[model samples]
Target: MQSLMRVVRSASALWPFYLAVVLFSSVVAGLGMAAPFIIREATDTIVDTVSYGTPAPTRTIVFLALALFAAEAASAVFSNVSGYLGDVMVARIRQILSTRYYAKLLALPQRYFDNQITGTIIARLDRSIANVTQFIQSFANSFLPMLLQVAAVLAVTTYYYWPLTILLLLLFPLYTWLTALTSRRWQKLERRKNAEIDAANGRFAEVIGQVKVTKSYVAEVRELDSFGTHYGETVALTRPQSRWWHSMDSVRGTAMTAIFLGIYLILFLRTLHGHLTIGEMVMLLQMVTMTRQPVHMMSWIVDSAQRAVAGSRDYFRVMDETVEPTANRELVAAIETTGAPELTVIQHSPLDAREPVIGFEHVTFEYSPGEPVLRDVTFRAREGEKIALVGESGGGKSTVVNLLLGLYPVEQGRLTVCGRDVADLGVEDLRASTGVVFQDSTLFSGTIRDNIAYGKPDATDEEIIEVAQRANAHDFILKFKDGYDTVIGERGVRLSGGQRQRIAVARAMLKDAPILVLDEATSALDTKAERAVQAGLDELMKNRTTIMIAHRLSTIADVDTIITLRDGRIDEVGSPAELASSGGIYSELLRLTASSSAADRARLKAFGFRVRDDEAKDS
Candidate 1:
């Protein structure tokens, strides 16, 4: 009940529309009450005329018929108008809820997404919003008017005959108590059902996204069986749940039938004994019948309310989560105040050449307790220096990037970007000052031009073309026959791996931030393409503070400093030449690369590695 009320309170902005709906519904209810009395009057008049053996009062009968018709017609018209208002209010509430949900998602930390499935998150939003909206509409159009009608019926029935009113009053409490008994168990089952559905939807999305992997393994039947098992479990739960609900409903139904039967018997006996007029008995019966409709609908309202309560609980669970702090206020204000917000980029004061562009001091971090991904790690990148991080998989290379961008909070030691503590800096400011090219080359389904200029949405065609040329993507883009306008499909699926990587590189280049982080930025490219893009990157790195991760040892040879990681601790940090002779992780990797196959050596040579004649011949 509290959760249901919270759903209503959340839409307080639409209260005026709700007010209108209630007012219109009140008119419909009042008119509905008039019909019973009008029928009773006409019935008594016809009986009197026949008993007296008088001429038929045709005009009087016609007048009463027209009054009845007018009342019914007005009731229908008002009911429709109220329904329309209810629909409008539901739409507005849906918009408000959906916008809030989306905004909350955007403000949540990266770790929240790490443990949640994309499809499950989406399913919860869709289902919760849908149920809440349905309930709101039902309450406005059916529930409110039902209550009003019941109250009017009770008042009218009590005025004419208190016995029938007593029976009607007793029925409500008994019916409600039985429903309450079943609801607790029914709601529990509904929650279980929702969990299963959410999981199934999550898996469905995962399968569709990775259909290629499933097909390669020929595990279609396996996936289908797994998917069906979730729904099957829900069905298993539903059997007993349905039985319990219907069993209680049957009991409530019997109770109602017995009470109404007694009320009818009393009405008939009273009319026969002259304690009541025929007209009075008829009016009371009509009013009691009117109450029956609401009584029958009570069960449906309870069922719907239960579903709504469950959904609202789910909705508020997300709403109650702590959101990350607001983005850079100054930047936001500038954008808000500017006439051309797209053209405005917040500029910070320049740092001295001697100051570190990035600094980490004994930083230790973990995604889970007692399982650190980075342990007491320290590193520094000075302004205008190109630093490279080289390590095996799961050595916290990506975590370092994630922390620097403020995707995850730094928990143990001090980390600073541009001399400002990362914890003190707004995530938007930290990210706005840095450009990143991730390993996956994530791209949206859009034109080549759109993807390239994604980082700088206001980028001109000439600027986009320049970066594309630097990334060695211009020639391939033109060959698509649409130049830059060709749609690349989702995540650049239509493009080759190398082509996608180049576009990603161009995006980062277009961002033109002071600091650049590249996580295997050129890993997908061929030897020739890598060399060309590497040259372009080298030129771009001249006056920028660049940090990169490279598995290919040859690629980092030209960097000013190399930070080698082994088991999350910095194994060595020195210039490339110094590390080559340090006999550490970097030196070991160099030896292994030097002794690799001919094709590997040739690839290394393309990145300006010195391949010895003996080592080349051995390969």
Candidate 2:
């Protein structure tokens, strides 16, 4: 009900159209009632003339028939106009809702998405829009017009048959009672069916997304059985719901027909007794039929309202979500007060544009209260320095990158980039100053050119070619007959792991931000692919403040500094050689790598690490 009211309030802009539809419907209804009156007059005129031993004139009968036709013709035209206007009003409301809903979805915080299934979210949104539309349409085309018709019929009937008007008033309560009872049960069925469908869709989408994993684990038969179970549950719920809906419709339809017949029988008996004329009986029958329509529509209108209310609650829940602080005036003002350069641009500046490009000063954060993900994490990287963060899986490696990107809020202390506090920087400004390549590279469904141009929408062809060349993606891009124009399937499924990583590097290169975050960038690839991608990474890292988060220590062997994290705290930070020689956390990790294989030992030796030959031999 609250959702329905919200939808109505949102559609207040179309009040003028509503007014016009109401007026048109009233006019149509009035004209429609005129037909019965014309028939009443024609019948009386013919009967009176013939009963008095005089023949009824052909012209009089023809004139009455033409009058009835004119009334019907006017009614039809106005009804169509009313219907057209009502449709326009509904469409305008839908357009308004769609725009606001989509904007809300985009502005919502990442956590909202993380906690929801993509398919279920989509289905809920679709149903919300449909519910609002159905309710508005039902009210306009069915309920409101039916009310007007009822009022018009009562006004006319009360003048000639006052007792009949009283009876109609009394019967309304009985009809309302019946509709209420049926609608309650029907609404329950509808709500259950909706939940079943959403659950089924969410499960189905989850399964489809993990199809590769299922195949790898040889769980195809299990997955098929799971899907079948979900389908069966949905079918089981839907069958009963549908049966209830049809049964309620049948009850309403049967009651209405029986009531109308009873009313007709009473009127027929009245005419036979000479208490009512043949013409009056015809007029009364027409009014009863008009009244019956609204009475019959009551059940359907209430049912639609119930469905709408159920879906709307979930929809508005999303619209009311709290969004991340994309840009805050107070935060910006605080940063400006520090006398640092204002971070106004939403794109990367040249290499000499800023210094102390990325830093964390005793910063702390957590996803849940009382559970810190990072604590006292202080680090800084000057312009053109390549800093690497290496740690176990649960360590605060990814958390650091997330903070730098402002995906999560900084709860304590400060993080700075380009001499401005990152906590105070607008998300757009902070991200524009940095480019990121994640472990799982995600490419949208679009052409290769489109994906590359995503970060730099207006990038020129020459600029794209230059970056692609730097990232080592140009050759493979050319191998495709469509070249840059080649269409990549969802997440670039058409491209190999190496090709996708290179394209991601090219995308980052195109952004050309002063700060680069490479999070497990090449950790998933084979040696050959990693070598190819690393070469591109080298080109991209030049003259930029690079932050590399990797599990593979070999990847960051030559970085200017290495930071080792342990239990959400920085355990060691120094030049790669200095940390490896100190026999600290970094040294122990290096020893573990040194013992993995002779190849690792040789790689450590190549990186100038002092790995004893015995360490390699023992393992």
Among the numbered candidates, top TM-score falls to 1
* True-structure Cα RMSD, model 2: 6.3
Which pairs clash inside model 2? none
Q: Write the residue-wise lDDT of candidate 2 on 1-619 in tens digits.
A: 7778877676576778879988888888788788888889888787788788677678988999999899989888888888888888888777767655665665566667767888887778788789878888778765776688789888877887677787666557776777676666766766677777787777777777767788899988987787677677767877877788777668767766766666777789989999888888888898888887777676667677877888777777776676666744433332223122233434444333465687798988888789998989998899889998876666788899988887777879888888888666677778788899998888888888988888998899999999999999999999999999999888898999999999999999998888899998987887779889999999999988999987566677789999888889998989988997887767876676657566755645443334334534542
- Per residue, candidate 1 scores C-alpha lDDT tens digits across 229-308 of 99999999999989998899899999999999999999999899988777778878888888888888888888888888
TM-scores for all candidates? 0.90, 0.87
Candidate 2's error at 361, in angstroms?
Answer: 2.3
lDDT of every predicted structure (CA atoms): 0.82, 0.78
| Global Cα lDDT for candidate 1 | 0.82
Off by over 4 Å in 2: 182-189, 238-262, 269-275, 327-355, 597-619
